[model samples]
Target: MRSAVVAALALGLLGACSAGTEPQTGDPAQATAAETPTMLASAPVDLAAAEPPECLSDGIAYATVGQDAGATTVAWAGAGDRGVLFAPQENGDVCQWSAEVARLAGAGYLVATYDWGASGQAGFQAALDVLKATGADRVAFVGASAGGTLAAGLADDLSAVAVVALSPPAQYGDVDARVEANQFTGPLQVFSSTDDPQVPAADSALVVRNDKTSIVTEVSGTAHGIEFMAPDGYHAEHVRGTIDTALSQGFGEG
Candidate 1:
């Protein structure tokens, strides 16, 4: 069993830490939208100069859409032919992404992964590269934990695909930070449990969209990391179901 125990700094804004402070490895470099030169005022992305592509995980291949001109490098499996992308909850590395890649690959999807740009905004920047590089006929964003935040921020970018976020923290910005449901243009299906102490269910309730049906699963006695850290893994069904639904809608699959 590949242990999901990654460097503590590898996860989402909320998964590994408490309110206000986010855990990051290496020197903490902060960049605001203004400091981003490659990005234009017209788009949330710059798409001008791309970060040089490199892989931080073994077994996961990385490639960019443009020749380092201005696109995110996509992390993907070169083998499977199914159209699927799995982003692990910010629990750590491509740890969970690896498992899901194997799972969906086995289930017959040409599964791919995009680096979440694990170091800083550079990581998020890489994630954007992965998406643009994919050349996917249809796509879906399956975000786990902190990965969900990137998925949410990429909603406009991923508009062509469906988004399935597991254990989406109420606020990617803060603990007490209430995400006005308007924060996302979601046909978003959020996964949660009653036993979760790390992220409260109340937060998800606030951000849930009233337009599409909001399905919240309150699993008793379960906490965060339910699928990756469990025996029966009650969360897997929700995970699978959400991905399947998104893909079906994404590709117009029946």
Candidate 2:
């Protein structure tokens, strides 16, 4: 577990404190044709020229897209042509500073996160569109909570390099992760804690595809969503290790 101060700060923007701030609008993907292309023209942030805030990790360049759609932020690190899209928990904004997201950026992979604008699948699809347009040789998905369910449900359509879902439910609205998981053949990593109150370990297990490449890591702590990947939070290293391993093994393999 993180220290009291760290835990409080992390939780502040994750969900508990981020209500009503999220935009309630139509899907950004459905924006005007002119707006869609502009959002996809992602440019890299020059980290060496400008200093990143203390909240964001060093070595990673930052950028944004989908402002017209719903504001999608992207962080890039390393030299790999592969990219990873990170989806936050329910009610969490993609623009918020997150150490876990920063770490993924630092690992030398192109990373993207975005606001869904309450458009559900459309919002998620919009984020994926931006990632694919960036010219990345390969791409993957990582999400927590509601974002996790979305990732699992759309993995097949996205043709993701792999997927890593933390504390996710088996379904989100009409999207069933279990049904979608059965069709995905890539490496899938699902993390769950037996102590999580919001999502039971059993519910998380419902996503298991029972394939040789699928893995469900059950831990003892109660951290859910992005907290599960916080450096100072419980199961942080495990989350990082899983992503690192999956990216190395699955990224750009095709």
Q: TM-score for model 2?
A: 0.69
Cα RMSD to the true fold for all candidates: 14.0, 13.0
Give every collision pair in model 2.
Answer: 77-108, 78-108
How high is the CA lDDT of each candidate model?
0.45, 0.60
Candidate 1 residue lDDT tens string, 1-254 = 01221211123111333111111233212211111011111222222222222222322333333334334444443222235556555535454465555444444344555544433224444544443333334555666666655454455454535566556675664322123534445456666667667766665455456455345555665466436234367556556666667666655665
Error of 1 at 90 (Å): 3.1
Error of 2 at 43 (Å): 9.5
Candidate 2 on 195-218: residue-level lDDT in tens?
Answer: 998999999998977677788888
Best by lDDT: 2
TM-score of each: 0.59, 0.69
